[model samples]
Target chain A: MTKFTTRLPLIGIGVFAVLLLVVAPAVLSEHWISNLGKYCCLAIAAVGIGLAWGRGGMLVMGQGVFFGLGAYAMAMHLTLETAGPGALPGFMILYDPLAPLPAFWEPFRSEVFTLVAIVLLPVIVSAILGYALFKRRVKGAYFAILTQALAVALAVLISSTIRETGGDTGLSNFKYFFGYVLNDEANKLMVYLIAAALLVVCLLAVWQFNRSRFGELLVATRDAEERVRFLGYDPANIKLFAFVVAAVMASIGGAMFVPIVGIITPQEIGASASILMIAGVALGGRASLFGPALGAMAIGWGQSSLGSSWPEGWIYILGLIFIFVILFLPMGLSSLFDRAKGLIRRSSDEPGPATPELREVVK
Target chain B: MSVPDASLVVSDLHVQFGAFVAVHDVSFDAHPGEVRFLIGPNGAGKTTCIDAITGLSKGTGTARFGDKELLGSPAQKIVRLGVGRTFQTASVFAQLSVLQNLDIAAGLRRSPVSLLRARRGVDASVERALEETGLGTVRDLPAGMLSHGQKQWLEIGMLLVQDAKVLLLDEPVAGMSQDERTATGELLGRVAANRVVVVVEHDMDFMRSFATRVTVLHQGRVLSEGSVAEIQADPRVQEVYLGTAGALSGALAPGAEEVD
Candidate 1:
């Protein structure tokens, strides 16, 4: 098949995604719309996971670290915005009303700083970490373990600093987002729209990456890093680039998630949370263009419904789904789409009358 | 990109892995337009020497491509210096098509911004390489499905697409049918016509037919370096082949000869 024809499914997905995000909000109830917005945030993070884990073979189990970074950055700014310029945040008042506003939380008062920090913090951290890890050729399961450990460390650090980070209770109780009353239902819908739109943008960006030479090189490095090295390319740098991009994507997801979810906690940025993010990507199909995002949304939706209905049994059901997908559909749900397409094509292709040469060849 | 006539020159190269010394004081000069084959016994450290030159292994030596010092350079830098190599085992991107495998090697744009631009998927050089390596028929097929011989050719095609001046291959034709071997020998000859080709292989018939010069290595050192005919006639080369274990014994002499 030509490149254009091969891209038909991706284009179809892009259209479906646009319709779902732009049109569905009008028909769905306010609560379901917000739920979808939350799913969009998760989907954004899962897209990055798919790129790093599925395409680049870098199992980034610490995405929650970047997500948490963005989340807290935005949360701090929102908190500061709610309070007057010199006044302390409400959470700090609960811990120590006498103590002055922390020096570290001073810069987040500026809206631009928080926005920049949301993208820059993850980029800087992931760059340094990726450089060190890839330079030493730390990959496969070792890389995954290191990233998971980082998530655990971040969670522990956040949990220990009770007064500074709102302790285990986490950051919440936001009254405003960018000077607009978040309490207003219209403004809430606007936040959901922004998150949904950003998810689509992330999907487009990933689509570009999937078709680029860099994407091809990334996959090549994943498969046979030594061969890519022989091809006048540094496998480490290639992997590092993908890793950093994934981090930035995760950060953006986390930033948007804070507004939609109205909470940021150590529990959401721990090793288990990171594993949950990976589970969604793995269930969808890591290598497929649309699979990761769709899979993440599906999983997030399942959690919202299933966890609410059977909070005790939901984890078991998700585990079963993960096991089933892994055991039977190693390529994930996307492979089924491909198989179905192949079957249709086969059935549609009518056989011509058999020639003597063809008969002899078959014999 | 000076297009140095002497593309690769290794002198006093040594590779030691912990307590075990893999390669010791191995040296050679590779010139443009000549196919030099490094033939040796099973444990002769030929791969170590190649790895040392390509910067895959840490070694103490002066490996110069023109005026550029290559000993301490990274593998990517070494390639950018116009030296390309193929693994002992044919390693192609199994998930990608033959055409894509070549395009990725040909496209050489390694940068963060390069991720935004869509790859053309085929270039003139990629087309030429595909035609030259006889993989044109299977260009669209995934490389994983290719026969062993075809995969080897595809890898060579990958190197060609890189526009490499110095091509180092480890056992390019290790596993091939007689017909495939002959075809590969011809392909290597054509590839070496305009570039410096360094091959580490065990096929005596292939070396005798294809190599312009042969470097015999034994016990991590250079045993002999001369024309294929001269090396074949040397008694020391014969003794090493005959005396080494059964694995090395099977390497050169197709039928075993009495050692006495």
Candidate 2:
């Protein structure tokens, strides 16, 4: 029985992988497949939120900053790649036809540098920001507000710099991905497969982290930080580590999001975007292994389908679903699975010897 | 073998909270295998003095644990240097199991990278801690579900697993039953057999039953320090702890009555 219970996670992951990578591609239409791919990117970001906000209890309300950083890096590289060496990007021609491509754009011309930046920029930023914030013992709503402020600041900064970043209109009109023809249907499907595969990889990473001793310490720090300190573990450094991991995951999601969606914008990496990422995780069961990914996809699907049908009404519908989940299903959709497992176990087992309950009695 | 002079020595220690002074020029020496009780009225600076020594609060002067100085370091650094402490309230990781709580505590003495390693069977130290704290029976239960007495035992067990040479407990038996208090007193006696255990408590009966040495604080300074017998006989100690002679018999005894 113990062995069966321990193997449950492995079995679940196997099923998830089969359904995500094998089953979905075989059945879904090309348009829906592309949509699912976008959801997978969001799911990748949600996995990080589950680690930081759910497990570590950091309440990261500004994940958009990391997501924006990753998205812009990839978008810049794609724009430069399409512009084809020494030729200015089409948008830059409209703004200032003779202006130099800018010093920052020179580095993105190298694919190696862009790829490295996608991973490192968010890691370095989160590490420095996390170290300063956590060391000073900033947490709860104060931490949340600080992060949200950073997301807003980045969005506004990007919107005002039209000459360099394409302003409120945002970066679009990509013609190639790593020198492959972007308009090809097969290539689009390939991008979808890559996004789905990366989502699975993120899940596996989180699974390893959840079972590690650091995972236990993160939960302990969440519950009683003072006790962990007295036990000789620095809570700040532990929190910083989780925060950095979350940032990297979000950055990866954003990096993939550019090719899959075919555009990158400030609106997609704003305060609302960060909150939407969290809403999906919360709807799925932020603490569970599969909750964040499934919840994110469900929310993304809702926006695509429900939003097109009713337009502005989709936000209201999404708000209602979020509220319902928060109110009735505080543990999110995953609690239903846990409840089912518990019921099955209880029905299968025989009655055991009764033991006295240990209840506290105040004198 | 234990280090030479493994005793914890504090001299001329002063604890100030902003503009207010909580402990003034306090000094004491605690050796290994000794269980010392710190007793006094509300705001007597007993907790403050312990906090300073454990690096929870900063202090002026020296708190020497063998050759290492403890006063200026951070709380986690102080704990890593061999001083461990428990809160006034029993603060265990509520979500984790009893066994996991001890496992994480034991990680303190091990390498930081040990977190990546898989958990093996109950090692000797954790096994000993679980047995010593009498928590082996319910090691698999969630710590939050444990009774108040059990939580206190679990926190103390956490200290033991860390291989702490000096253990500071705040109000160790504040809300325990009479039977639980006696059991805890016995547990402390066994736990302090090879390490320094300093308890900040208010239960006079438990203190009388377990304390080898007593330090009495009043107005942020040590009013008296001696054996239990000397403290019981001191008129000033009685006046401070028990108030007037008329009020002595109200809730607390005034050395005249047999305790135990």
What share of the reference contacts survives in each candidate? 0.79, 0.69
Clashes of 1: 0
Best by lDDT: 2
Tens-digit lDDT track of model 2 for B63-101:
999989998999899999999988777899999999999
Per-residue lDDT, model 2, residue A73, is: 94
Q: Write the per-residue lDDT of candidate 1 for residues A213-280, one digit (tens) a residue.
A: 78888889999998888888878998998999999999999999988888889998899989989988
Q: What are the runs in model 1 whose C-alpha is more than 4 Å off?
A: A1-6, A350-363, B1-4, B109-112, B243-260
Give me the runs in candidate 2 sitting further than 4 Å from their true place.
A347-350, A353-363, B1-4, B244-260
lDDT of 2: 0.87
Q: Write the per-residue lDDT of candidate 2 for residues A115-162, one digit (tens) a residue.
A: 999999999999999999998999999999999999999999999999
Residue A294 in model 2: shift from native, Å? 1.1
Indicate the DockQ of the complex predicted as candidate 2.
0.53
